[model samples]
Target chain A: MSAPRAEAVVIGASAGALEALSAILPALPARFPLPVMVVVHIPPDRRSLLAELFQAKCRVIVMEAEDKEPISPGTVYFAPADYHLLIEHDRTLSLSSDEPVLFSRPSIDVLFESAADAYGDALVAIVLTGANDDGAKGMRAVVEAGGRALVQTPESAFASAMPRAAIDLCPVARVMPLAAIAAYLLEV
Target chain B: MNGDPGSEKVEDIEIRLLLEAIYSQYHYDFRSYAMASIKRRLRQAREHLGFPTFSAMQESLLRDPALLPRLLGYLTVQVSEMFRDPSYFRALREKVVPHLRTYPSLKVWVAGCSTGEELYSLAILFREEGLEERTIFYATDINQDALHAAEAGIFGVDRIPLFTENHRKSGGKSSLSDYYQAAYGRVAFDKTLRRNVVFSDHSLVTDAVFGEMQLISCRNVMIYFDRALQDRALGLFRDSLARKGFLGLGAKESLRFSKHADAFADFVREERIYQRRFE
Candidate 1:
């Protein structure tokens, strides 16, 4: 039997995420085939500089996701600070400010669940370091939709709560250290 | 309401039927809204309105006319603030206001004006710019309650601090306190500020343009719409705008993907403000 291949990648992180992201994003080559979508918890009132900061260091193009914009390959899209990022059936991006879920506007669970619905089995979801459990239910959703799920090993994470919660919900998810995650992504 | 394994599919169908019923009965077209948020709001409504399922909620909504306002309340009210994005307003004041000053008389349309925060912000801005006497503002929204609240111009006293800070950041020439009077935990913005303003019921999804506008600020409203509906609203804005008029969208909203993109030129790209093309 052949293994399923991923068409796109969605990642979620929170507290102490910038360090974890720097380790992963800069390692990807400019020619990476799939689009990457990310959600990192940020203050609702402030403008985010995540895209510009990552784009300066990473080989791949990075941009803040815009509403109704078409997803592009070889580009990384970060969710805007105050809105929930969603993936439409047509593979376009959308933003919503209806209400915050779990005390966060750009909720990891919201993005992960929506992407799971959009990409189904072709999706690859990753949960990284965070102080909260926002991504646990979302990781489970991704796994249930036949998508692959990966978590940073709790011991290696700067903040272990998020990965531990995800592991509790999705025990079968492949756990990798920060350094190995980049290599595994390159292989995929 | 039971969490059965496949209840997600069942709930989706029920939501569609409920939206269809609301449209057919109320003539408020929400059927084309972005589905994810709509589903979330419907779930919230179903739970808060004490219905076992969306079907029961739809049945009650159809039978009781009084339920419409409560349901609309859930579907429409979003958290908003005066000068929510200070930088966008600063761009408007610093960059866009110069071009707007050229017109002898101006008409600014604040579509989906919510509870009038943006409208008041612009009104105070115009007053400070010494253009208040020459401008007429149209503040519009689909929610009757919101429109009424906008007309009243009363905001909680607790919100004054942030509003004051935002106004300062947007280059206010006068004190924000100069525009309102406080009483009993609320502030009633001076009535004279809205003397030249009109608060009306308008829906971007169904309403037609009532007048040509020099500048139309419709921020964050279209994020709820689907592609076709967004294009339709953009078409209305394009038609309503006078030659070389301006349109300001929310920070997250953009015209790049719209069919009407060709009609606009980036006025302040970072701020999401666009100018209507001469051709």
Candidate 2:
């Protein structure tokens, strides 16, 4: 297996992602070296409780990155309401009220593209269960940036369209079940 | 009002008529708000008004002055909370307050200050920061009822806990309860907070600049406007601000890609706080 060395992980998931995230985040050990960033599709105006909700489920500290907050390893960051969360040069977060892509701010594509730029070869991009094709382009960006791309196997995902879309767009490294992904990440 | 096939033209014409009537009768221009949001609100008003058609609603609006208030209620989204978006308030306290202290007498405008949550929040912020004595806050909105509600400064007791938490989150130096007195299922904020606040009718859409200001907090209201209207509102903010004055917008709104992007640099870009570029 050509196991690409992964230092940071970016996960893009939509409607059915919480199912996958629940399994993946809790399954990772406390000593995991990589940081995780997630973009969950939601309406722009409402408040997000993803950080608080995930904190109870996972060992890693979960937080919404304030603009310019440094992204640290072993912590997980979720996008805040209505703002696209991007990675700055210093590995900190940058937020923009820029126009929505795929009718979503905090878009999966925005996060994945920025993560690709920041972490390049050491990045691991995951496309989980989602109803739409939002993460496909960004998943390709991850692969093109010399990062590893993984998709939840469609038959195993809660929704298959998103992972299938990514598979179509790029030569995704693996289409693993959600449980296998967590274990694989730990070993690699 | 319900619309069948071939209703788009009638809707447009009716909207223009209602807007023109509002302009001539009320002198409140809502002509430029994004068509979709406005239409949605108007539709809600029609449903509430028991009118079966836009034409019927238009006739009633044209005839009854009181109906305008009901219409305004639906059009103006007054959803607000004290210390809403606590981090933005925290940023203002840390970054903008110091600059405001330099002014001997300060004027701050809370433009589109729906229901005055941001205005009262600012008042509390100013008082705690020791700038209240010299500051005059002009809290303006197009909705008369919302202005009235803001001027009254009463909030539901149920909301106090959340608001207090938000206040603390914004780094309050004192107990949030100290700012308001609980009575009869409501809490009346302290009069001292509003000693310098003047609530009045002002519309960013139709009204010209009234006075130069040291700071303007127009949050959330610009999202309803299209880019042209956003540009116009931004221009108004630019014009109303003193040299090096501050501008704050909603979390989801920005000056980036707007005509005024270069006119102001961010104080805290994440919080959408900016200071006018004087140099």
Candidate 3:
């Protein structure tokens, strides 16, 4: 498939997210053009340290996504531990305490589906290393909306279920290794 | 071909008309809510409620009075647990309770107290703090069903374990089992917990402030609203607070950049607890 143009990027990772995201997020240059929203499956009882952990590694701004905050062009927004993060068509962030999807509060499908609606063809959705099949349905939404879907090549992922699911759902998706995934995003 | 590639724009138009129909027919003002969540919910409603389109749903809604409550179940969120945020409750116990105890008689409003989880949490907290007898708790929501469920004060037995753990983490003084009786996979909290509580139908979006409150805990509710609607709710909280009263929000919600920012001073910043500024 031809490389699609991008306006924003949404990524979902679970189980092995820390190592998976570490390979890609920190590689983005300072003040990257598009907003990057991330969902890493986390236990609702504990505080999320992803934003703080990544802030030390990345040049881009990293913080938990807050409700009603307008999407800044260059910042990286991480879904907080318990709320499902979404992007409105108006380009502002929204948080939901509505029922969790598939027992995961910060569900990857929730973010990917909403971001697809907001960005449509201009969105790039990446499904990374995870132990579950959460992001597959969301990948279908992204692909159906004409947005780009990139899955980390399953074998290269620490746990392959998530990316494998996405690839199965959207056969048109581009499958790549961690290093190539980072390079692909940098080009966008 | 006329609409956006995916016809997403058409869906937005359909959704707006549905929300408008809901308001005109039922007097519920969800027109100004955050569209992303509203759209998500409506899609679920349309699929599960057996409507092919939002327009079709609106058509049924305009004609059927009975459909209003069922549709509302979709529009308003109703998921919560007692003492869901342990640190916020811990902050309340350690920091805000002393100030609250200063007031001779306290009025605590649990704004948007869905399904009574937060209300019961506060009721138990006040009782433990030695203030329940002197406090009048107003539990309000726009949804009548949620208000009634909250008044019933029964929760799933499975949820009690989490509630118990959270209570312990929030510096709970008494055994959680002392407050509720578990029977047939459901736990009904002690009826005395509601002795000083008033369950009422109130909307933060449309209802005016009814009483001055010493402490207001409106968590996770404002996240459903757009910025302007949130400003309206925050303004209501500001006006309803007594001087130096406290307002606590959901962990991720904040008063920063709100139109009512100056009306509140940060009392416990990390816990998203704010104090009504004395002006």
Candidate 4:
């Protein structure tokens, strides 16, 4: 059987997200074909340093997603702090200030469900090290849309609850280490 | 946010129908809002309101007039923080106010004023800057409930701390406490702060331009709109502003791609403030 292909990737994480994401974001080649959209739980009060911090390390272009901006390949888009990121059918990025889901503003499930609606089977979703189960519903959405889902193994994660929940909700998601997930991105 | 959108799924069809229903029955023209936001809110509405689907929601909405306001609550996001993005307010106080002072009397429109957080922030800023006496503030929103709340200017005391901190960061000249009295877990802003303020029921989506203004502060409200609706609202602002008047938008919003981009130039690029252009 042939390996499934994906056009874009969406990642969700909360606690321990920085270290877990650092391993994968910096490893992608400059010419990476797919765009990576990431949602990390950060306090709404502080301006995020994720884009600036990752831009210096990642070979691929890294920046905070702006509303109505078209999805561009060879870039990684981080959800701006405190706004839920969504993908439109036209592939333009949209941000929402609607009530937070699961006490999270930039919700993983919001991004994943919208991306699934936009990309369907051509999407790839990842759930990484976190303390909360924000990404579990998103994982299920991706899986139900026939998109591939990768969950960081609970034992291998810095915080296991999030990844463990993703597994419980969407068992078909590939259980892998962060290294393998980075490898999977390179395969694109 | 206006060209024909790509609506393909059964859910999309249902949503389009629901929006149409909303417009015809309630006169709320959400048909042109950004599809992604509409869809997101629809999902939330279905879950929270216990509608099995958009189809069911639409049916309930058509028959029950009482359901419209409840649904509009979900459709329009009313939650906002006072003095949000302090830098934006700081830039307004430092950069934009200098130009406004040139005019003997000023008009400032707070489009989509929501629950008055932004309106109160601006009112306090103007008052501190000594522009309050000369300024007439117009605050407008589509939601009547929100307009009433904006008019009342009372907020839970729990929100005051962050508001106070933000006010401080925005180069507040006077203490935030000077403007309001706290009691019973709530603070009622001195009504005198709103003495020059006018709160109105207005929808940028359907309403026409009203009154020429020296400045218009319509922030994050545009992020809810599609690209086309944004252009329409921008056009209205362009028409409404006096020559060389200013416009302030949300932190993430910009005029770079709007059809009315030529009507304004970046005043404080970092703060998304723009100045009306001759052309």
Could you tally the backbone clashes for each prediction?
0, 0, 0, 5
- Clash pairs, candidate 4, are B1-B226, B1-B227, B1-B228, B1-B229, B2-B228
lDDT of 2 by residue, B88-123 (tens): 999999988988989999999999877778898998
Tens digits of lDDT, candidate 4, B1-279: 234576367788888899999899889999878787788888888999999999999999999999988888888856998999999999999999998889999999999999999999999999988899999999999998888899999999999999999999999999999999999999999999899998999999999997789999998898889899999999999999999999999888888768899889999998899999975
User: Scoring each candidate complex against the real one, what DockQ results?
Assistant: 0.65, 0.04, 0.85, 0.71
The 10-residue segment with the lowest total lDDT in model 3 chain A:
A1-10
Which candidate should be chosen as best, given TM-score against the real structure? 3
Q: What is the lDDT of residue B262 in candidate 1?
A: 98
DockQ of 2: 0.04
Query: Deviation in angstroms for B245 in model 2?
Result: 0.7
lDDT of 2 by residue, A1-188 (tens): 68567778888888787788998988776667888888888775478888898989888888876644567888888988777777643476666544578888778888887778667778888999999998898889789878988899999988899999999998656899998889877876
**Candidate 1, residue A19: how far the Cα is off, in Å:** 1.0
Candidate 1 Cα deviation (angstroms), residue B186:
2.8
Which wins on DockQ, candidate 3 or candidate 4? Answer: 3
**iRMS of candidate 4, Å:** 1.0
Alpha-carbon TM-score of each model against the true structure: 0.92, 0.64, 0.97, 0.96
lDDT of 3 by residue, B108-211 (tens): 99999989999999999999999998999999999999999999999999998899999999999999999999899999999999999999999998999867
lDDT-based ranking: 3, 4, 1, 2
Candidate 3 wrong stretches, greater than 4 Å? A1-4, B1-8
> Where is the poorest 10-residue window by lDDT in model 2 chain B?
B1-10
**Chain A TM-score for model 4, please?**
0.98
